[model samples]
Target: MYYGWNIVGVGMVFQAISFGFTIYIFTFWAEAWMTEFNVGRTQITATFMIFNVAMGLVSPIAGRILDAFSIRVLIISGATCLTVGFLLISFANAMWQIITVYATLISVGSVLAGPLAAQTLAAKWFSARRGLAIGWGSTGTSIGGLLMPPFAIYLLLNLGWRQAHQVIAFLIVLIIVPLVWKIIRNTPQEKGVEPEAPARFEPTQESGGQAVQWTTIKVLRSRNFWIPIIAFLPALAAFSTVQANLSLITADIGISQQKTALLMSIIAGSMIVGKLFFGGMADRWDQRLLYWIAASIMGFGILLLMSQPNYTLMVFISVLLGLAAGGFLPLLGAIVGGRFGPEAFGQVFGLLGPFLTLSAFAPMLGGWLRDTTGSYDSIFQIILVALIPAMVSMAFMKRQAPATQASG
Candidate 1:
C-alpha cells in the first residue's frame, strides 16, 4: 500500500471541485450576469478571458512556488481563496467586480488547487506509472464538470446565482481543506517510500523514453519543447471557447437549458473515459501517437458542432470532444514528465501557462465573431482552419537528450 494513492484521491476530489467551481460553473451564470449588468456577449466573454489571463500569469509563478514548499499549504491557501472569492462574488453588484474576483482569486486559486497540482503531485510520486496516476487524478476535472453543472443549474434555479455562489464557496471550504491536510504529502519519502523508477536511462537514442533533468531555459530552446504547446493550442482554444459558451450556444439553437446542461455533463463524462482509458494505456502504448490520433478525432467533432446540431448529434459530438480533452492531460503530463523528469516539471509546466492561456482568448474571439456575424459558424470554421497547423507542429518535436549523451 503506497501513500501516493491517498494523495491522488485527495487531488482527484479537490481538482474536481476546483474545475467545477472555477470555470464550468461560471458558464451557467454568464447569461445571468449579462442580464443583470446590462452588458453584451463580448463583455461577458471578456471575464473568462481575464480568468485565463490571470491563470496564465499566475500559474507558472505558482508552479515555481509549489516546488519550494509542501503542496498542502498551497491547496489550503487556494481553498481559502476560492471560498472568499465566491463569498465576495455573491455580493457583487457589478460586472467588473465579478470579473475581478474570478481573475484575481478564483482563477489563480484554481491553478494552485486544481489539476496542475494533482498532475505535479502524481509526477512527484510515480515515475513508471506517471501517466496512469495523472490520468486518474485528472478525472476529477471531468467528473466535477460532469456532476457540478446540473447541480449548479439546479442551485441557480432554486437558490439564485448570488446565494448559489455562497453555497459553492462554503462547500469548498468544508470539503476540500480537511481532505488536503489529511491525505496530501509532498513526496513519497515523507512516508519512507521512493519513486517507482527514479530515472530511465536505458536509451542511447534521443527518443522520449527517459527521465532526464531539464532546465526551463533548455526546454524553451528545444523544438520538442514547443511540440505539445503548438500542437495542442488549437484544440485547447476550441475547448476553451466551446466550454465557456456551450450553454449559450445550446440556448441559441432552440434547445432547453436542461438538455444543454446534460450535454455539458455528457462531454465531461466522456472525458473521464478518455482520461482513464488513455491513462492506463499510456504505460503500454505510445502516448504521443495516441494524443495525435485523439486530436484528429476532436477536429472532426468540432466540424460537426455547428450552430444547430441536433440534440442526438450533439450528444455524439460531445463524446468525441470529451474523449479528446480527457486523453490530453495524461498524455501531455506523461510526455513532459517522461522526457524532462519530475525535478523541473513544475517550472517547465509553468512556462507552458502563457502559451496555454493564450487560447483563453479564443472565447473572446468567438464572442467577437458572434457579435459581428450574428452566429458561431465562422468561429467553428476558424477553429477548423487552425487545427491544420496544430497537427503539423507535432512532426518536428524530438525527444530530449541527456547532458552526457549530448556531450558525447
Candidate 2:
C-alpha cells in the first residue's frame, strides 16, 4: 500500500514539472519572449497556439506510444525532449525557430508523458481508491502551478528568460529522468503481484492485454467518452486564456508585473489547496455535485475578474478563481475513471486529450481579442456564457454507478 502511493507520488512530480513548463509558465515566458524575439504580443501568443495545435494533433500518437512503450521509456524520452525544447527556445532567433522548439517539440514532450500518462499509471495501481489516487496525482499539477510561476518570474529577472530555460533544461535532465526510470512500473503483475482487484469492476483479461482493446475510433462513439471532453471544453478555454493573459490583464489595470506574478502565485497556491480538498471530497461526495459547484465558483470568479481591474480586486478574485478552477483538473480524471472503468483508461483518456488541448485556444483568442478590441471584458463575458453549457452538461453525466461502487 505504501509503495503504491509512492509510485503515484513520483509520477505526480514528473507531471508537475513537465506540465508546469508546458502550460502554466508559458504566460510568464510570453512577455519575455516578445521582448527578446522583437515580436509583437500577438506573435508571441501565436506560438502558444502552435503549442495547442501540436498537443491536439499529436495526442493519438502519444496514446499509441503509451500503449506500446514502457512508461519509463516514454517519460525519459519526454523529459529529454522537454529539456532540449527549452534550451532550443532559449536560443531561438526567428519565429519559425520559436515555433519549432517551443511549440512542436515541447508539445510532443508534454503529451507523451503529461497528466494522462501519470494519472493512468496511478489508476492501474488502485481500484477501490482510484478516484482518490487519480485525484492525488492530479494535485501535482496544482502544486506545479503554485510553485513554478514565482520561480519563473525570479529566474527571468535574475538570469534572463534564456538562462531560465537553461535552468529548467538542466533540472528536467537531473530530476525526472532518473526518478521515472527508477520508480515507474508498467503493471502490478510485473512485480510478482496478483491483480489489484480480480473481477472487481471488470475481469482481469485473459492475458493482461492492453487496458482497452477499443481503438480510438470505437471509443469516440461512446457518449460517456465524449461528454466530459465536451463539458470540459469551456473550463480548459478559461484556464488557457487566463494562464496566458492574467498578467497582462492585471497590468492593463495598472498592476505591475511583480505584483501580477505574486497574484498568480497566490492563485496557483490556492489551486494546491483546492486540489487536496476537492480530491478528498471526491472520495466522500457525489462528483457531479462537486463539479457543478466548482464550475459555478469559477464562473463567478471569471465574472468578478471581468468586472474588476485593480490590484486589490485582482488579488481577491485570483484566490477565489484558483480554488474554483483547481478542482476540475482532478475531478475530470475521476469522472473518466468512474464512468469508463480502468479496463481501457489509457486509450479512453488519451482520446479525451486532444479536445482538452484544443480548448487552450481560448487564450490565443483572448490575446487576439485584446489586441483587436483593447479590453479583456468581452472575453470574460464569452467565457461566462461558455461555462453555463459546461455546468449543465455535468448534470447530464449518466447516473451510472461510480466505478468504485461497481467493484464494491
Candidate 3:
C-alpha cells in the first residue's frame, strides 16, 4: 500500500471528525445555545457569522504557518484549540464567551484540519491522482454531514447542547488527535516516499520564469490566484446563503419541518456521490467542464426549488444541489493544483480565506431580500445570475503552465 494513500485515508477521518463536531454540529447547537444564552435570533445567527469570519480571516495565516512549520505542529495545535474551545464552550457562562472562544480558537482549529489542510496534505502525496485523493478525503465532509447531524441532534435532545459538545470533545480528543499524530505525515518524503513527479524536488517555473514554490507576494500578484478567489466568492456566498436559510425557505413553501430535515439528509447523502463522481472524473476528464457544469446545475437547482415550491421536486433538487455542493471544493482544489502545481497550493488556496467573509454575509442578503419582497424569488434570481459569471471565469481561465512548459 502506498503511504500517500494512507495519508489520504487518515486525512478523510480527520476531516470527517473535524467538520462533524465543529461546523456540522453547529447547526444543531444554534437554537439550543440561543435559548440557553437568551440571545435573539440575530445574535444567535451571529455566531455563524463570527465562525465564518474567523475561518476566512485565519485561512491565509494557517496556510503560511502550515508551509513554514511541520504538518503535525499545525494539526496538534489546531486540535488542541478545537478541544479546548469545545470544552470551554460547554462551560461558557455568557453568549459572548461562546462567540469569543469560537471566533478565535475553533476557527483557527478548523483552518488547521479543515478542507484546505486536508487537500494540501492529499495534494502533497499524489499529483497524478491529486483530484481523486482530494475528492476521497473530501468525502469526509459529506460523511460527517450525513452522520453527525442526527447524532448531534440526538445528543442535544437527550443530554443538552453543552453535554453534547462535551461528548464530541471527548471523542475528538480520544480519536481525532491521535489519528492525526500517528497517521498524518506532512509529505511523503518523511517516510522516504517519492512523489508522482520529478519537479516536486525542484521548483517548477511559472510562465513569467518565476519559481512556483510559495511566496505570499508572488501568489497575490498572480492571475490564477485572483481568478479562483473571485470565482469561488459569489458561488460560496450563494451556497452559504442557501444552506443558512434552508429551513426557512422550505417552511415558507409550506414544506413541513420534518420533510425539510429529511431533504437535508438527502442533500447530505448526495454529496458522497457528488464528491466521488466529480473528484474521480476530474482525473480522467476536463476539470473546467466539470466545474462549470456543476455550477450550472446548481443554478438549475436553485431555480427549481424557488419555482416549484412544492415538496414534489424537493428530492431531485436536493440531489442536484448536493452534487454541486459536494463537487465544489474538490473542483476548486483540483483547478488550483492543476494550474499552479502542488508546491504553493496551501498558500494559493489560503488566499481564498478572505472570500469566506462574503459567504457569511450572503445569507443576510438573502434574508433581507426575502423579507423585503415577501419571497425568496429575488434571492434565487440573484444567485442564478451570480453563477453565470462564475461559469464564464472557469470557461475562460487557463491552466497556467511552468515557464519552461510555456516556452515550449
Candidate 3 per-residue lDDT over residues 367-392, each given as its tens digit: 88988998888977887887788777
What stretches of model 2 exceed 4 Å from their correct place? Answer: 153-158, 193-213, 371-374, 402-408
Residues 1-408, model 1: lDDT tens digits:
667888888999999898887777776798898889898866676787788889888887887877778889899999999999999999998998988898888987899998888888998898667778989999998888777877898999999999999899999999998889887888888767765754343222335444444656777886666888988888888887788778768877788978977887788889899999888777667666777788888888888887478888889988998889888888888777766667666777777888888888887788778879989889889888988888887767664334334432
lDDT of each: 0.81, 0.76, 0.79
Error of 3 at 407 (Å): 18
TM-score of each: 0.90, 0.88, 0.94
Q: For model 2, where is the 10-residue window of minimal lDDT?
A: 198-207
Candidate 2, 1-408: lDDT as tens digits: 646687789877988899887777787776676666678866776777887888877776776667666877888888889998989988877767978786677987887668878877776777666767777787787777777777887998999988999999999889998888888876776555554552134322322333445656767777777778767788768866787777778778788878887887888788877777777677567788988878887887788777755778787888877887778877877776666655566677777777787777788778778889999888888988888887787777774441222323
Clashes of each: 0, 2, 2
Question: Any idea what lDDT model 3 has?
Answer: 0.79
Candidate 1 — which residues are off by over 4 angstroms?
198-213, 251-253, 306-308, 400-408
What 10-residue stretch in candidate 3 is worst by lDDT? 198-207
Cα displacement (Å) at residue 165, model 1: 2.4
| Residue 67 alpha-carbon offset, candidate 2, angstroms | 3.3
